[model samples]
Target: MDRQEDRHRLDLRLALADLVADTAACVRFFSRLPVPKLCSADDPARLPDFSQISRAIPLAGIVVAMPAGLLVLLLGLSQLPTLASGFLVVGMLAMVTGALHEDGLADVADGFFGGHTPERRLEIMKDSRIGAFGSIALIVSLGLKAVLIAALLDRYTPLEAMVILLGAESLGRTLIVWQWSTLPAARPDGLAHRFGVPISKTFKQACIFGAACLLPTLPVLPLPSLALGLILAPLAAHGVGMLAKARIGGFSGDVLGAVQQVGTLVFLAGCLAVA
Candidate 1:
């Protein structure tokens, strides 16, 4: 029965393989974290299942944002001005994520506000060049985030500040997944289209995963912060999604990025309010 045992063993190994691959795939896709090897030269099509991997986006957020939060914490401990610490934290996030969300925000602003029609809007979004609308929107969005993060530093202990940062990161990314799951891709091809839309099942799992990622800080985070983050983040996502659907015909990669940027601000504001 050695052959039978070998077949059973192979089945178990295949089953166990998915547990790690799914999480690694999300982390690899969203951040610069050194996740498990995902690419297969042997078979290019044998890639990680992004549909399943979407469920781990929030968990990936924790991995991605930790360094930025820790840097801010250390800066605060060193008696740096709150503004500088906030600025550094924002910089860290941009550097780590390659400013993908920020890029998305600018593109969405340029496309949605600059274009006269849906077709024109999608074309504008695809352009790499930033315009006046994008310039203004990025400045406004980033400025608000920096100011609010500074407010958090002023209102709470360094440890709590880190917790708040983590919560915001997790919540912001969850919104991206939620938006992607619900909205149709606005264009025939692009980053967002290549990624494809997540199904309802994936969306629900992502929400649960995002919430679970915040569990460590639940005891220390202000009750109001918790409540507000939940409410505000989704509202931000839904509002932006609705706007994209109406303006551009549906969501694009840029729309996903824009929502994450916007959702982070609202989520942080809500949490900072009760902090």
Candidate 2:
């Protein structure tokens, strides 16, 4: 009995350590923010296995966005111009995330729109050059985000606005689990291939993460209105998945990024409308 108890405790300790490492890996991958220095020797590098870290991806989003959210709140409360504050928050987040998702949005726009064939589309996305399609998409998406943030500033108190931002960021990352779960890689290489599909169990854990993100803000929000905001995420993801199926025949890294970007926009938009 003593031996069994020790073994169980040992196992639990190892699991917790792995969780901390994976969380650090995720934060490093998803943001430019400095990590906690617990794993200083390796925290800057992207870890080999994203699947192990998938569970923390949503939390990573909250981690990355919180600073930007705070900045927005500060600016709003200080009586800065709403649109200017919104754009600054958007730009700051772009920098903080190393423009990862925005890059994906541009690549997806160029690939999905510019390629006459699926192979051509995938090739274009990999080119790293911005085309007319990518240019327009970047401008539009950024514009939309700024507009939404500004609208939220007008509609809610600074703290309430921050809640919407936090929830949207968390929920948006969680929504990527659907893309990974439902789709295959567009090519035989790259992130979609490397990470593969997260198992059903993993996917469910992501949903729980997203729920944890949203539930905290619920007390301040109307249930019916919050439902309206919450409903946009999956519906938008379904639409993104369907388009990927028809166009690329599967998801690529760009598709995953596109999902996050769209999820962010629609979730915040829903919250604004409902609020």
Best by lDDT: 2
Q: In model 2, what lDDT does residue 242 have?
A: 84
Report the poorest 10 consecutive residues by lDDT, candidate 1.
Answer: 39-48
Number of backbone clashes in candidate 1: 0
Give the worst 10-residue stretch by lDDT in candidate 2: 39-48
> Which clashing pairs does model 2 show?
none
Regions of model 2 farther than 4 Å from truth? 1-14, 36-46
The digit string of per-residue lDDT tens for model 1 on 101-188 reads 9999999999999999999999899999999999999899878888888888888788888887887888888999888888877877
Q: List the residue pairs that clash in candidate 1.
A: none
Question: What does candidate 2 score on TM?
Answer: 0.91
For each candidate, give its TM-score against the true structure. 0.88, 0.91
